[model samples]
Target: MGKLQQFLTGLAACFGAILMGSLNVWPSYTLELYTDNTTTLLTAPMSEFESSLVGSLPSLGAMLGTGITGVIIDFFGRKRGAMLLILPIILCWIIIEFSSSSIPILIARFMGGVGGGANLVYAPIYISEMAEPSIRGSLASGTVSLYCLGALLSYLSGWFLSYGMIIWVNLSLCIAALVLLSIVVESPMFLLRQKNEQEALKALAHYRTGSTGSKSVLEELSLMKQQLLPPVELVSVNADAEANEEATEKEKLNTDEVVVVVPPKSSSLKLLLCACGGCVRTGANRRAAFTSNASCRAFLVVGTALTLQVMMGMIAVQVYAGTLFKQAAPDLSAHFCSALFALVLLAGGTVTGIVADKAGRRVLVISSSALVALCMGALGFLMQSGVAPAWVSAVVILVYCFCFNFGAGSVPYVLLAEVFTSEVQGIASMILVEWVWLLNFVLIAVFPFMKSLMGVHGAFYVFACVAVANTILSYINIPETKGLSNKQIQEVLHPKVDKQNSIDASLSVCQKAVFQEP
Candidate 1:
């Protein structure tokens, strides 16, 4: 896309990231109200389980939301899919504004989670669809970088604002995101899939060149069609008409002949079961298999990269920052420490966005993970040995924030979109996003118990080990995809195709496998 249009698209995506930040750190500030001896809710402070649920239920809601977002976007279009998220967020804030009891607060947080989940799934997909190859990685990562900024805002507001005032500010943000997203053009990919090629061309021109009447619009449209379309079976005319079909008859297309696989409106659990079942199902797995070893490796690289992103414990830190800081330094204020952590994270994400297309994905992920591991190990040692001062945990957390954001935080979001071809992108993203949420829930839910078992120090020691393993895996597997076209990346992944041959061979393999009846 042209610079101005690209900027607008990135801006819209970044707005969603900001909303995600609010959802992310929602608990960090709000939970304090219930847990503090200064306050009373439902007659008493939240018990451990209630506290855990209050913080973790949003993840449960997010997991559910992301599971169905793909089908919603597929059927309703990305713009509408994003707009649908706004109501829940607004409702969430409204409920929070009026809530006097714990139950209403819990429900409000769940609603916020629902909105956050959609933002996470849709932002990368929207940015990837709208961006050109030269700037794709940079733009896709920008959403997450903005997410860090949003988190910073969340922490700052949580620290300073009363609950009612914070809800109003968040409500305003939700409305703002809704207005911005409503005006953006529909995704060109969705238009083409619906067989509205003329409109798709207009969108491409508007999105890419900032004009629907540009002279080169058709050329760009043709390139898009070439990359996405393949020869396919069409409805047959009567044999008598068929004789004329090859010679003089106009081509009759049947848009209805296309398969529409809108998955049932199910929660994340059903989706996970369905994904696993599809893995062993005969035709489905074969069709979606990689085109060649390189492609297979590329797929593995990205899938593992996202998983490693979760396991790195960065997100867990976001969710449980208050708890960790409280344990690490009793003398320091948890609220202030968490805010500082988020600020460092925001800086890291900014640096990652500037450097993503230049420094490349592999080196950053490895380097970031390595530094995180070292810091985690050091923090664990200090806490365990009792030789550490109270300030040590704060310093280590700041360092970890920088390390995590520099690579593990932002790059995975970019690659999540960049990894798959257009054909398999939707399913791949749905599954991967679900995986991320599931892993996030497990880590956060078990974290306090882990602390009980091993103390906070031992808990971080385990995280340090996971970080070390992730560093090794990223170093060995990730391919650099800085500035290459999707088509070129496809070729790199599925090298079995003749270098001269286009997407046909790869599409043929995936189409049959991707579309088989379940």
Candidate 2:
């Protein structure tokens, strides 16, 4: 494929990723409006049994669905896993649109949550695998950018259309997802792991050449196949060792095959510790040398960045913006406030994508976090003092939004994924994402209560503190990750002691297995 075609393909993959991630945000955007209206119309307090039941049921269902779908993602290919999710999401929207009672709407929302959970897992995997390594950060971060776009669009739709129209709009999104899937190929990594050489070749060819067939493509396919092939000698050695161990154990038994076996007793704590210490002395001592290194520091920074970004971007801004505006201008419409917030968020994400590669990840992270902190502090002061105008509040919030996306919003995943080796990349990514979701859940659930108790000014003071802490952490710990390959990042993160021990341990194991094999 030509450079243009490859870029377009990458763009499509990014767009798809964004669309999939958007499913996760729809519930958040609409829940407040839906719950408040339902409470008033039912002639009950928001926390009354019936009102709370109707309002909270969907989120409960979504949480349950998210748990189950997270496990299912490992078995199904990312694309197929995501595709499976669309059905339930579409069904949920349909039910929400047509149902009269709270029960049906709750059920639909729960079902949609299942799909959203699956989408969260699959979208990043698909985009990262399909994109060229040179632009992988941009492509991966595009998922976030697009996700914000989806959330913005959802808010816009809700602001302009009736509740019924919003359901139809969500359904249309699911249908559009299905159509897009038909054109996109499965992840090459998934294909390789499945041992589908021909399919993997086809994917690599399409990814590299864009055209179906050519001499150059064939050569590249051959090289990919060779590169992906397993080591037959290693397999042979493992099998031989297993067979020899079985024979040796059999030989130790009586010829009559009447050997009595005594059950091994469990060791006491003292004995277990002694045995463990002995094992450590016999070369397992290397693990102690693996204490917090550059990589570990990077992980910490990345995780913090992720936590703060989601907190500031969606939870803080979406939940509190209208209230803050209302404090300044009592007549400001919720719809108008929400739309403006969404536009600022979209702008932040869009600008981040354009300059991230050039400005570098670490610099953007520190600078952006600092800027957000400053804006947040200003907003808080404005809210505390009665002298600030509504427009000042909005302008400060926009600055906060822009600075956030440019730094914290964009760099977390890129840093986490790039800092680890391929062997541990999946685990690292999972840890970062798990934290993201956990923090998001906490921020969303407690935000209203926090705002009520602290007021808008105090709430923003908390956010500013978080932003400042995040900035300091990034500056001290996270290294520049731009223009560096994954291996290089890993090397920078792992200290000499850890690196040497790892090498020695791996070599020792390989040598023992090789020399002792039958």
User: Candidate 1 lDDT, tens digit per residue, 35-110?
Assistant: 8766744456776777777877778888878887788888888888888876777888787677666778788778
Best by TM-score: 1
Superposed model 1: Cα runs more than 4 Å off: 35-49, 210-216, 231-299, 315-333, 452-455, 495-518
Steric clash pairs (candidate 1): 287-513, 294-493, 295-493
Write candidate 2's Cα lDDT for 1-518 as tens digits: 53344455444444533443444455545556545755432233233354444434444544554455434545676566656766777787777677656667667766766565444444555655555556666755665677677777776776677766776777777777777665677766668768886787677676775543777656655644543342221111222324465564343332332222221222222222322244323454332222224435555666667776776644667556666667655676766666666677778777767776678888888898889889888988987895767778877876787778767877775665456433233445555565666676678778878879998788888888888888887888777767665546656765455555555543444334444533
Q: What TM-score quantifies how close candidate 2 is to the native fold?
A: 0.76
Model 2 clashes, total count: 3
Error of 2 at 4 (Å): 5.3
Off by over 4 Å in 2: 2-73, 210-301, 310-314, 329-332, 420-422, 445-455, 498-503, 511-518
Prediction-by-prediction clash tally: 3, 3
Worst 10 residues of 1 by lDDT: 248-257
